[model samples]
Target: MTLIDLTPAPAATARANALPVAIIGAGPIGLAAAARLTERDIPFVVLEKGESAGAAIREWGHTRLFSPWEHLVDDAAVRLLGASGWQAPAAGRAPSGRELVDEYVAPLSAHPAIAPHLRTGVEVLAVTREGMDRTRTAGRSRAPFALRLRLADGTIVDETASAVIDASGTWGQANPLGSGGLAPLGWDAVADRVAPALPDVLGADRERFAGRHTTVVGAGHSAANTLIALASLARDEPGTRVTWLIRNAAAARISTGGDELEGRGALGARLERLVADGRVEVLDRFEILRAEPAGDGVRLHGRRAGEAAAHDTDLVVAATGFRPDLGMLRELRLELDDIVEAPRRLAPLIDPNVHSCGTVSPHGYRELAHPEQGFFIVGMKSYGRAPTFLLKTGYEQVRSVVAWLAGDAASAGRVELTLPATGVCSTSAGGCC
Candidate 1:
């Protein structure tokens, strides 16, 4: 059966009475919000900066998730998937990024709950109040926030919504490898050699390193996946040397999912084995001070966390981290948290007293909403400097925002969903499920 009607033409005029909600980021969390909103019969639209669900996943398609399928499965996400007859794999293993996106995120977006509202290739630049609506902008009126978006095609559209959710992941911005600025010491004369955002593990440019020395920095899952993938190509491509430079004495590894070792848990073990096999060199607790020009390549200078000795490398891949873009909110009159610029207090259900999705920290949710009633930050960016809770937080935000918009303060306070514990995948074989 067709979940949505489409005859290649617009249908007859119908009252556009549904409440408008705009979700930024089409990843798991954004899609999940779409699903939840759809289930509640809420009318909304999803704007994805990337071309598809899990673009970051597609970038690292060769890599497996740190969490297993069970942990990966958000309750709402699973229900939507099930409705489409998408059976959960039984082995309970962590699937690769591609598999997770294709089988889960992409499929879920197509579900009846979210399909009509899913719009890809749209990048949300900012969320602010509607013009002349200072009452809502200042928290005095119950008007929703206005969203200013720039699509991939360069189209600028201003849309008003009862709420705004930001699910854009930390992966969008790459934390630079240099401190203060590009290391002033080495390669300063030819800084162009540095590729700010290096290609993802499966990026085409990665192929040029086939028979050369390469150094990878940072210790997150992205870095982990890159090391493993490069190691796998060693046998097929001779003279391919790998060096891992992490600040930790030993890599921090997290095993994820099922009885099978395919998740982050498995990758950690695999990395250890690769280290033992002498396929990759591990440089723990060191830092790069500068990249000095050396004959043909660059010599990297740095000291260990405690030691003063420096190190060297031919190529560097920094997987530091990311930060959010506050371009749209820069000039807004709303109060911003000193750190993250997110509304200090956000009560999605429209209640003036309740700040449901403010800060998920020891301080609880801060009062970022100010006196303004309609403004809200609904996704990962909402967390600001807070340790990102990932998709779970976004899901919670939307639930509260929807309730708040519906003017049910009591219901917003009562809205809570339990997330699955991490690990527990259905496929554990080969650790690349």
Candidate 2:
């Protein structure tokens, strides 16, 4: 697995420092990191598998964000875009994912300072140290990082960098619908019957789910948001039914709000009321074990109260949240939490059992570092399987990381941001952060 030969520390640092920093993904976080590097005059390259920036978010553009534009926009990006006459959107108005790309991501990516360094349709297949595999230890810390890239034209190439910042998000790697953290029986054949999280049920996907029964499997914000949209669709389209599935004995996770639109999160409260009013059906303690195609629909087989239970539905929405695709980092040295899969030091703070998207305290490079030198995983990928990442938090992360890379320890250690103390979004339409 080794490529370039290893060298001594002083010589390796001198040679590696001359190489550009490599950033994976061109999403908001990746581009923000690029902006920070650009502001510091540090040479960097951004590689995105998508042909355009924010490609993943574009898939769910119909969903509206709860956070205002002020929180979505990165300070370093703002400074760079502002100089190019790019005016910020009104601070208080929340934007849909499409609007976010149009009003922010596109402009930032097109900025004179960043456009040249942005490489679209470039996918990074793997990341490891030059002349080193996961087993090699001596002088591994001093070797430059090697990246295997798949280009737009299907050509493979090798690239190296002084530092690697993985802002590649987890939006593409949604978790399975099975109960035991793996795909259910017959998943391979009936996979098409399953839908991703936050499907545009009211708009783009109205035809597919209009009069069909959908079994939504999950207890997170994405599940609640999809339920709201399906409920709304049912109002206009007859025969539209939603079956809420959960492994827990009770649906306590979605009943956060106290029967009223409180000061904090309210999405859960709306969902609770809907369930109470019989607008949606609940199937708690149902652990899905198998799924098979039954006619044009799908048959979900699971256990309820230790007994066999099965349900036939036209579609299944697996809003089970996402997990970081760490397959590419097989040769890297990483210390991640056993449960959440987040960086070890950051796991406790962002773990779902203890922290919420808005409550996770502001942290920086130190919390994101790996045993492999100059490698940091930022953005939603930093949270691993936990669905508790905010865009602003990603911005602050890169700010600290870039500062540390630039030899500014003081700025890297300082916490300059504060987050809202609430949990999930206040509106049902607001999906994951």
Candidate 3:
């Protein structure tokens, strides 16, 4: 890594210096930023749109993560949690989303140093420089950021911050089912037939998939996890038909066999065997074009290998991956890659079309920054449309960004991270859809 020492910035305007740094989202990465700022004795605020912290992860809490406990817990958060007599889960135990939040996120949010700065049930409508839009440039770096927010009670208010780190993940912005990356025709009318990316099959959502013809779409781990669950459901419930679809010629690259991510490798291996046993139907090179009503179910119109095709199913688990919500940041000037929508410098490292390594190179604030000074996109959202994010990557992101904000340039610029035994696989370059 090149040594780019970001020495302590002399100082900023009085207004900018007095304001606290604003960190968006209260998930693992956002909260980790808070802890890092606290360690630096810097004031900060965390805004969350959900009712509580880690709201996005809680939505898919039933699904187990491919990485284990050690990789999930952020170092700064551990420092805070450890002081309160918190016990760490076994290093090798891969936990479900629920366990991740309950064991690590919940306790970190409740920590006194961090809790006072966190505000849940609030939404950030837009972000821009005070008294200026993206077009204005004079003195932009000196001006504090103006955040337009809607309160839980629907009241609108404006907040200001010296710097902003958007750790708000991409889970809420699910990719559409269309082959062209847009929602298929008649999508809104037939939205009720689609299940979430990670439906609680064999649990809360079992009744929806049991004894029904359910089709799982996409070619990522999200699809694999749902397929495995639905396959299990078929065993106990007769007449439960399962079908898997992918845009590629073959169904593969769910996960790679490696020494590091055992849980993920196991998932890919099991899914392959399940498909071989003829328990789940495989549809490759299938492109969805539209949707229409089919009695009580829905018929998806598409093309299979340039020929028209159709499939009717009672339920559909899109599992089509996610994308960052760029609409709210329109007022802020951003330098994004045209294709992936990530920071231009970071896009090349994570672009699945260009990068095929087992893992990405270590990166920090320098790679995460945009043209808008003092603003950054961190965590999974930083990867833009790429689906190669891991919890440890986000941890490193906030750590460096917060250090730079605290005027510790050396720590911010000195990026050192490695995801052992892993590399990029057949991930979708088009937002993992």
Candidate 4:
């Protein structure tokens, strides 16, 4: 790894004179904040729990973003990367998550302006107000915040900052799978008898699934991905049979960059193709009730949509989505939404009237319309219930907040670009749809 230290030549005494700003999470949003701070000449340090920029993106790096490159990349990010002579992907192309991290995020991190201040693998466990301490700024003394951080190596460090922003994204929580994400007869009954978790990508546990029938549930992107991956495996593993259960009569398509899946979007299209080949059993609008060990496999009891009678199946999977985990914030004195437990509102400008020192709203987009003060939340963790548009929203929020921090009120507002209205999938044939 190349390390370039850009700290001023002045002694440590002089270096500690500047006010600090704490930014958590180094995804696209955090990079935006760093870029804005660089342009404004603000002295700040960014803390990222991940090993590098967009670590979350790296986890699903093989997948494609639902939005086009234009929506994924922000203006501030483009400016920084441009200074280093980096060319961006074509405007409307949907890049894979890995591509977004590499071409867009990595270059921004290498920028001299933002690079020096970013400390990777540093997770912020908590942020609290420090008592007043007068410090000379220009000619008078001013108060600044004292930040507390817990690094990945279990090191605890404290520093002073004037502001804080959160770009942690939705990677923090898991959406509930309904009924504890297991068939009602109890998963333990079939736990030793079924395939392993995420088996499509990881490969089924042959001892448990060979010559066995299985069922999967849900209608979201993740569910689609798992089903498609499994279908491909079935081509060679003929002894395995698979069934897909959807609560809705039809699955919704996940669209991006003029692409659409025939069954819905790309995933829906893939599933449709799988169905055509007799590779999967499609049970639309089926609600599961229970499951139990029945001879060789498990018996899953559920009612089909509009059907008064119950039905049976061999194995079941819960593919429902996730929600924000408020366990960490339980001690903080902040308002939460009744339904999702996310912050209620956030202002673009950091005014004390809008938010307290340590909180963020659940719906991050709302923060663009009404800014929050002191506390800022970025990345997917801030997206709460809606993660489909997380990348676009996170990019905008950081740009707006950093601009306001630099005292540029004109920069805060709704994004001007219109999201692509094309079908969820197209002839372009992007994978991980």
Top lDDT model: 2
Per-candidate count of clashing residue pairs (backbone under 3 Å) = 38, 0, 6, 37
- What is the RMSD of candidate 4? 9.5
For residues 177-231, could you state the per-residue lDDT of candidate 4 as single tens digits? 3344444556566666444223434333434444556677666666666677667
Candidate 1: regions farther than 4 A off: 1-19, 132-144, 180-206, 248-262, 292-297, 302-312, 332-397, 408-411, 415-433
Off by more than 4 A, model 3:
1-11, 256-260, 354-358, 421-433
- Tens-digit lDDT string for candidate 2 (1-433): 1122211122347788898999999989999999999988899999999999988878878777767778788999999998878899997777888999899999999998889999999999999999899899888766899999999999999999988999998886978878888999999878898898889999888999999999898887678888989999999999999999888977554547442214224767778888999999998889889989999999989899899999899999988778999999999988888888888888988877765566778899888877776888998899898766777888899999998888788888889887655433322222243
Tens digits of per-residue lDDT, candidate 1, 167-199, equal 675555655566543543645653544443334
Candidate 3's residue-wise lDDT over 1-433, tens digit each?
Answer: 3223234442458988899989999998899999999999988999999999988888888877756678778898899889989888899677788888898899999999999999999999999989999888688778899999999999999999988999898877888999999999998877899887888898998888889999999888788888989999999999999999898987555655642355667878888898899998898899999998888898999999999999898888888888899998999878788888888889998887654334567688888877787888998888888876666777888888888887788888887566666532211221221
| TM agreement with the true structure for every prediction | 0.73, 0.93, 0.94, 0.70
RMSD of each: 9.1, 3.8, 3.3, 9.5
**Ranked candidates (TM-score, high to low):** 3, 2, 1, 4
Q: Decide which is better by lDDT, 1 or 4.
A: 1
Candidate 4: clashing residue pairs, number: 37
Candidates ranked, most accurate by lDDT first: 2, 3, 1, 4
Local distance difference test, candidate 2? 0.83
**What's model 4's TM-score?**
0.70
Candidate 3: deviation at residue 428, Å? 14
